[model samples]
Target chain A: MSSIISLKHLYKEYQLGDGSVFTALRDINLDIHEGEFSAIVGPSGSGKSTLMHMIGLLDKPSRGEIIINSRDVSTIDDNQTSTLRNSYVGFVFQQFNLLNKLTVQENILLPATYSRRNLDFDPIARSEMLMEKFGIISKKDSYPNRISGGQQQRVAVARALIMKPQLILADEPTGNLDHKTGNEIIDLFEELNKSEGITLIMVTHERELAERTRRQIRVLDGEVISDKKK
Target chain B: MKLQGVSTLFTSSFADFKRDKVRTALTSLGIMIGVLSVVLLIALGLGLKNYIQNQFESLGANLVMILPGSGFSGGRGPAGLAGGAEFDEKDVRSVEKVPNIKYVVPVYIHSSVITTADKEISGSIMGANEEIFSLINIDVQTGELWKKTDVEKKAKVAVLGNTLAQDLYGNPSDALGKTIRVGGMRIKVIGIANKIGNQERDGAAFIPYTTTFGSMNPKKTFFAIYLGIADKESVTTVKSEVEKTLLKRYDKDRFSVTEQSEILSTVDQIFGILNIFLVAIGSISLMVGGIGIMNIMYATVTERTREVGIRRALGATTRDILLQFLTESTMLSLFGGIVGLIVAWIIVLIVRNWFPVALNLFAVILAIGVSSGIGIFFGVFPAKKAADLSPMEAIRYE
Candidate 1:
């Protein structure tokens, strides 16, 4: 099967306030296959978040090529990046970045409104099914602030899946949840990977969460230290 | 995106506004006041102009006046000698012979005290020929007007205007045969003329021109001549003929003739300038309103930075971001303009009811257009700023 995502010799550098350059990621290479549930584990300032940013097409790498579904997106502008992200990738942020003002259903329907391609799924029915599956059905009309952190993250996941994107990039999606809720979120991701075959790329500091994924990579000082597949 | 999506965006924006009702109302209030001020100012200007125009129209269009000039040395009246020379009975007789000239009445005026048995009132005394009755419409409330024979014979018969009659005899009817003192001469009131509103001629006692010239002080040689044309259509021709006749009789360019319409046009020109001045004054307020909109929009950008980030993450393009902010600013201005229009209309109605002015529609439209333009022009910078925010940084913003 063709790889859903590929990165080669990726480098991301940031200029410090003192005008010295600090390398956030260096000469990184990675491939994520279809339906693969993978995690990038790292300490603070270890380049995992930077890598996730590049992978999600939210930030451009200083040097390298990134091919997602065989389309190279390394030098793309903001508009093209947004188009690609809307059509092919979905994001779940650590802060449960749901619009606090909108209800759960509205948050999920937001991506469809902005996508270049029409979303054929009935938003109401899709939201209903996702909420039912995630056991958040009763909270469909509730705002993000009214719900628990775990429920908010689940709603974020539901939003990410609404566009039927092939790739999901999650940045510490369960960092704010309790231990039980975090495990439950991971189990949901695993089930989505197994059943629906959506590739999952997550960045997390939790060793247990990283280990649960089928593939794991560890980074230190902006370079990869280990890569293993079970 | 489809139009349906745009409509959805509008609905969403409206919902958001509804969610924060107080802020929305406050923002709209700024716009409303701006619009209201512009509309009311323009309306008031128009009303004043209309009132002035109507006042001019009340003076008959075919009426013409001849003012005397002193000399033609430098188009300047000589010092110690008044600028305009005086016209005499000969000039009046010559103008009377002009073709299409219906009537020519020369007026001589002075301020004097007139007393009855119990009351004494000070007012203006005017001396005019019998033709003055035909030249100007004056309804006699009680008695007959002095005949042309009375003027020819230099008789002391007089007509009392409504105010003069009221002052001399207490009742307009009783003033008919009463005698009024004018500069030491007693003139018998033969008629009590009808009341004319707020005009210079409305409070005067009228007597024969010969009688006034004989009895009153003799140094004032100039007389104001009122020429009534036979045909309204011949007003221009009649005016020129009268001027030519007077010029021939006077044997110099010592007279100036003015048509009522010319005076009315001059008045209109003045009001037009006044309207422009008022509009300029109102524009300053509108500009302030524009700045208010810009200030509020800047605040909105800062407050909704996270919302902007969320929208960006959801795949909104920079253009979308720009449009959203622009739409918001424009909506604010449009709402303000509407509110202002309503307020202005109310003021116009009140003024129209209370005063003599007429309301016009052009000023209302101008107010609305100017206010909306202010909104769009001032809103662009903030919208661009909001649109240019870095999605990555914005999303990460706390």
Candidate 2:
């Protein structure tokens, strides 16, 4: 299978105020393939979230070659980078990250609102489809804070899928949910992967959650220690 | 961005305003006050100017005056209004002989106390010929005006101003045919002039210049010589002719001959300068208003840091974020400007009945344009700060 996103020799460093550098990601070579359900698994301070940010194009690497959907994005300007990220990738943060000011329906269509590209498909129609499919169409007009944590996660997932991105990057998507709610979210992701054949990359510190994925890339101290395909 | 996207952006941006209506209104208050003062001051200045123009136009356009010193340039003559040259019968006769010139009224003006049987009033006394009534638009409400024959005979017949008559006799018409004492002379009131709306002129009394010679004027010299021209077109010719005639008898520095329109324009020029000064004062308030908007924008940017991050993550470019905040600040300023303009318009309408104030197109345009400009000027720094935030860091900000 072709890779949806390939990161070559990625390095991320932060300069501390004390005139010292802290490396977040070091000498990373990874490829996330199409239609694969995978987890970037690590403990706290393992640089797993930073890796997800790099893949999501939310942050730039100090040194790397990033190819997203077969397009080299490392050298693009900010406007181009934003457009690429808008159309090519979807993000699901650990906190749900739903804007409380907007309704559920508005939230789902948020990605397409910022899309600068000429989209072939109608975004509103697809947002309704995602909401209907997720069984959250009844909550379309509800705000994020007014709904349950599970509902907000579904809305976030629907938002992630609305643009028809090549890759889904979820950083602890079920981190704020209760155990049963978390299981339901995992089930939702499992169904999206198996039924739609969409590329899914989840970042999780929980070992059990990582175990549910079809493949696991384990990392420690900014370096990948293992990559296993179950 | 697409049309729908732009709409969405505005909807979301304005939602912030909806949530904090009070903050928005308060933030724009500085701008509102700034715009209000500017518009109102301009309206007042315009009204005063219109009032002056109407008053001059009502007095008839062909009137000219000969004064002591430089006249409209400052002095009644070179000595100024305090102690200027006074014209006499000879000067009046010379000015009247100029072609196209009409009645030449020689005036000897003084302020003194006039006493009736039981009441006494201190006011201006205009000593002039019969033509003073028709030449200056003064109306006589009771009896008859003292005639030209009254000046020839040095008759002690007087015309009392409306307020002066009313104050002395409770009603102006009652004062008719009554005798009033002025400077040891008892003068009979032949007529009472109507209400003239001017403070000083409303409470005055008029006597023949011939009667005022020994008792008040003493030198038998006139304070000023006022001429009426037969045609508006000949006003300049009559003016120069009178000036030449006067120059032959008196030094050019000692007397001034000016058309009435020249005085009107000189007063108008003074008002123009005053308006400019008022505008400078108004602009200071506007600058302070701009700074007020900037301060609030900075706070808003800080408050919305997380939102900025989320927007960036959702594919908003740096420029998008910048434009969003910049537009918000500008909208705030424009909101103030529009409100101020409306408020000022309402005030002008209410004041129009009593005064001549008006709001012109330029003032309206300035309110909107300046407020928006202030918004943009003050908004840029905060917007730039918001746009410079890294999306990841912004999202992580508490």
Candidate 3:
């Protein structure tokens, strides 16, 4: 299968207020293929989030080439970068990040509202289907604050999948959920990966959740220590 | 962005505004106060101008005043007054020869004490021809005006104004046929003029012009000449003709003619300037209100930094975010502007019951335009600041 994301020699650096430079990621080289269900496991501040941001086109690498869906990200401007992100990437954050003011349906339809490309299908009909699949249809009119953490995360996941992007990037998706709820979310991600053949890249510190993915790339001190394929 | 997308942004913005009712109401109040003041000021100015014009119209149509010397000259009143050009019987005769001339009533005015059986009061005694009654639309409330024979015969008959008669005899109707002593002469009051609301006409007494000039004081010249034209449209023609006739005998700088339209226009011009000055004062408050909106919107941008990142991450372009915020602040100011208009309208309604203020649609529209302009203008800086935020940094903001 063709690779969906190719990161070649990606490096990210931050400038401290004291004028010292701190490198977040160095000489990172990795490829995430289509239909690959993978988890990036690492300790805190090990550059797992930085790598995820770079892969999602949420931030630029300090020095490197990032090719996503066969297009080099460096050549694209901010507007085109946003278009690329909207067209091919979906993100699930640890905080769920649903706007508190928006109801579940409005939050789920947010991606479609922001997409510049013309959508072929009705976003509302698809949102209804996704809510049914996620078992949260009854809470569709409720705001994010009124729902439980698990329901909010499910709504966030539904939002990420609303545009049917080529790849989904989840950062600590189960960090705030109970163990049983986290396992249930993991099961949903596995089902989506197996049924739709959607590429899934998740960042997590939970070793047990990382073990359930088809592959695990463990990062330690900004370097991938092991890449194990199940 | 598509219309649908813009509408969605507006929907969210409105929901966001509704979430904090107190802040929104207070923010809108700033703009409301500014708009209300501007609208009311303009309305009052226009209303006052209209009221004064109507009063001028009530004096008489087709009436013109010929003043001695230039109007710009100091220490001179209207015609025949001291310290300027002297206009007497010859000037009146010359003005009578002008085409479309109806009645040339030369007034010999004097201030004196009049005594009746019951009281004594100081008042102006005007000596004019019988045409003065019709020229100034003065109706007789009791008895009749003096005849042309009464003026030409130099009769010592008098007409008392409504207020003057009331002051002298305590009743306008009872004052008829009663003799009032002025300048040591006992004159019988032949008529009482209707209430015309002018201090000169409503509170003074009138005597025959020939009697005052020929019998009372043959040396006293006429003070002013009032010309009643045959047709309202012929006023300008008659005025120029009278000026030309006078210029033939005297210098061009010796006299000036003022039509009712000229007076009305000068009054209108003064009120127009006043309207502009008042509106400018009101706009300063509007500008402050705009700045207040800007200050609050800037704070809103800072407060919503995390929200901006979340939207950007959800695929909102920089343009999208910019337009969203611009729409939000513009709507905020527009909301205030509309509320201000409503409040202004209510105030105007209340004021109309007490004063003669005409509501001006143009001024109202201009107020709305200014408010919207302020919103868009002041909102740009803060909206730009919000749009320029880095999405990655924003999303990470706590």
**DockQ of each candidate, alpha-carbon based:** 0.41, 0.54, 0.46
Model 3's CAPRI class?
acceptable
**Each candidate: chain B TM-score:** 0.78, 0.87, 0.76
Angstrom error at residue B137, model 1: 5.6
Model 3, global lDDT: 0.86
Of the candidates shown, which would achieve the greatest DockQ relative to the real structure?
A: 2
Better of 1 and 3 by TM-score: 3
Per residue, candidate 1 scores C-alpha lDDT tens digits across B116-193 of 667787888778888777666776888988988998898988888888777666678987777766767777888888
Q: Rank the candidates by DockQ, best first.
A: 2, 3, 1
Residues B2-28 of candidate 2: C-alpha lDDT, one tens digit per residue = 423556656776887887899899989
Give the chain A TM-score for each candidate. 0.96, 0.97, 0.97
Per-residue error (Å), model 3, residue B290: 0.3
The whole-model lDDT of each prediction reads 0.79, 0.87, 0.86
Query: TM-score winner among the candidates?
Result: 2
lDDT of 1 at B24: 73
